[model samples]
Target chain A: AQSVTQLDSQVPVFEEAPVELRCNYSSSVSVYLFWYVQYPNQGLQLLLKYLSGSTLVKGINGFEAEFNKSQTSFHLRKPSVHISDTAEYFCAVSPRAGAGTALIFGKGTTLSVSS
Target chain B: DTGVTQSPTHLIKTRGQQVTLRCSPISGHKSVSWYQQVLGQGPQFIFQYYEKEERGRGNFPDRFSARQFPNYSSELNVNALLLGDSALYLCASGPGNKDTEAFFGQGTRLTVV
Candidate 1:
């Protein structure tokens, strides 16, 4: 089984300030990692995913995340923030193979960007 | 390309009532998954269907059930709704493979009173 943990419940930052949302996971087997964003009254949009190759993966909206195998972590980061970036971020993991095909998500972190 | 789409953007149902949510997967996608996101919490997996067959299920009870049609559209049914069942119901789709990622829909907001 695979499980994800997002370290923060909420993060508040000013526009143009950098922000990082931490995530960790526990899994006995190799897994695929992903980050998703949910805007008000909208569905979840894919931020990025770490399936293989590069440890650092970039996504839309200038967001990125790094997969650390040893640490079992996949943390999301953005060099600067905007008010439009305010949304909820979720960290998720799914097994690399076999029958466990569902994505396991963390409790999520609410990012609030202020001007 | 059209993305995953769900029906009835918002709905309100009384306690003990039943509700059915719908979803249409993207073109050529063969898998559909259901998730429930409550206020201030992350989404919880409910079920996953691939090629009109049940492939995966989450921790949700029997009250939560889903089915996929030959066209790859799906419906989620919840029986005897409770206040706690009020949440945003999300539908996702992807190619039925081990390495592919799922695409999500706009979601249906279900409020149980």
Candidate 2:
């Protein structure tokens, strides 16, 4: 079994300000980490993922995340944010490899970027 | 270029009624997974189907059932609906079982009264 924890439920930031969304996971075996964004009344879109290779992963929209093995964390970060970046972000995890491995997601963090 | 797609964007049902939700996966994708997202909460896994077979199931009750068709499209059936069943049901598609990226649909909002 795998579980994800997102520390913040809401984050407010001004336009052009930097932001970070914290995520931690608990799993007995190797897992794949992913960050997803959901706009108002829309489905989740994959922002980034960490499988095997470098710990630091870059994603679309100038966002990035670092996977820390020791800390069990995969925090998403952006150098600067725009009002269009306001959306709900979710952290998810799944087993490394297997058939029917479903993803388990965290509660979610709502990002509100205001000008 | 089409992503995953779901039907009946919104539905309203009474308690004890039955409901069916549909999903169409992306072209060339063979895996379809179902999830439920309640208000103010993240999505919960419900079922996963691949190659017209059941691949995985979540902690949902037996009242929740689903199946995939020959075309790889799927349908989720829920019996004896309860108010607690009111939630946004999402369908995702992937190329295969171990595929890393899964595309998602807008989801079907099922409201049980």
Leading candidate by lDDT? 2
Q: Which ten residues in a row have the lowest lDDT in candidate 1 chain B?
A: B94-103
Cα distance off (Å), candidate 2, residue B49: 0.4
Off by over 4 Å in 1: none
Q: Model 2: residues >4 Å from true position, as ranges? A: none
Tell me the lDDT of model 1 at A16: 100
Q: Interface RMSD value for candidate 1, one decimal?
A: 1.9
Q: Model 1, A1-115: lDDT tens per residue?
A: 8889999999999999999999999999999999999999999999999999999999999999999999999999999999999999999998887863888899999999999
Candidate 2 C-alpha lDDT tens digits along A1-115: 8999999999999999999999999999899999999998999999999998999999999999999999999999999999999999999999986767698999999999999
- DockQ, each predicted model: 0.65, 0.79
Question: Residue B94 in model 1: shift from native, Å?
Answer: 0.8
CA lDDT, candidate 1, residue B91? 94
Question: Chain B in candidate 2 has what TM-score?
Answer: 0.97
Query: Tens digits of per-residue lDDT for model 1 on B31-62?
Result: 99999999888899899999898888999999
Error of 2 at B52 (Å): 1.0
